[model samples]
Target chain A: MIEFFNVLLVIFLILSALAVERTKDLLSAVIIFGAYSFMMAVVWLLLRSPDVALTEAAIGAGVTTLLFVGLVSRTRRWE
Target chain B: MNDIIVKTVTRIMVPFIQMYGIFVILNGHISPGGGFAGGALIGVSLILYTLVFGVGAAEKKFSHRLGDLSESGGILIYLVIGSVGIVSGGYFLTNLDAGFLKGEAGALLSGGMIPLLMVAIGIKVTSTIITLFHAMIEEDPS
Candidate 1:
């Protein structure tokens, strides 16, 4: 059960990363990046390190996404 | 940004999120969470507020001067806690030897300087995140 979820998460992470890179809309890419980080956080939690999971979820998914969104808003969107 | 749902939810959730962050920070010695996680959670709550509201309102809640003072104050608190050991003729960061009140092992106040250090780290991390967010979002001079 856990292994299945792990595999699913890893696959989702790869898909999210690819989507982020291939997306032309910067906002979508940023959101995809956030999804990737969230998947990573889940992976960390499954690995039994809640500390790293918490930091990853908060900083990676939260702060980094916000910063990226702000930057995207400041700059061009279709790039 | 003007969504009423987001604003209302954020307003309702920020206090609970902050309380949980403090709980994590305080329970660092006895639990899985420590300063970094707790502080980041707190920072996230504030950022959520910023996202729902505006940067101006967020700044009003946590001003630049307050952030700066907290950034320095956290490290200063850490330094002072460490220097206590030296003042007591022990090595830097000496816990028990520094005469700190070490309660029972599983208690909240048991770890002595550890909780204090976690608090300092929490403050520093929270301030750093807020400061970075503000810096990134600020208007360009050019």
Candidate 2:
């Protein structure tokens, strides 16, 4: 069961990564990146590193994505 | 992502997740986790809230100065805890001879200063990471 969860999580991570790269809308891309952080956090939990996982969830999904989205909203959508 | 659904979900989830983060930070001793993990989780909750609500609203929530102060404060806490061992005993971070606290194996406060240090690290990591994120988002004057 855990293994299946791991696999599914990995798939979600990959999908999230692709979403971040491929999305036309910057906000959507940042959202996807947040998804990627969440997936990574799950992976960390599975690996028995809740500390790293927590950091991943916080920094990745929380701060980094928020910052990017803020920048996007403030500036032009694309660089 | 700024849809009503996202906001609603965030409203429902942020409190729970943020609380869990603090729980994880405090319970790091017996478990496989520590301060850094839990602090990050807390950071995420705030971050999620900010992302959904917009930066202006987020800025109103907390100032950059507070974050920076917290970062330094965390480090100072860790240093103070660690230094107690040296002040009381021969070596730095020497838990047993440091005369800080009883060394019960499984109790919450039994880890002497380990838990405290972990909490400090958690504060340091979360604040620093958040500040860095803010820097990235804030307009570069150059």
**Local distance difference test, each candidate:** 0.90, 0.78
* Runs off by more than 4 Å, candidate 2: A1-19, A46-51, B1-15, B48-61, B133-142
Candidate 1 docks with a DockQ of 0.65
TM-score of chain A of each: 0.96, 0.91
Tens digits of per-residue lDDT for model 1, B1-142: 9988888988999999999999999999898889998999899888788877888999999999999999999999999999999999999999998999989999887988999999999999999998888887787845
lDDT of 2 by residue, A1-79 (tens): 9899889998888887877778888877888888888889889889988767766776677767767766776777864
Pairs of residues clashing in candidate 2? A51-B37, A58-B44
Tell me how many clashing residue pairs each candidate has: 0, 2
Candidate 1, residue B121: Cα displacement in angstroms equals 1.0
Task: Name the lDDT value of residue A69 in candidate 1.
Answer: 81
Highest TM-score model number:
1
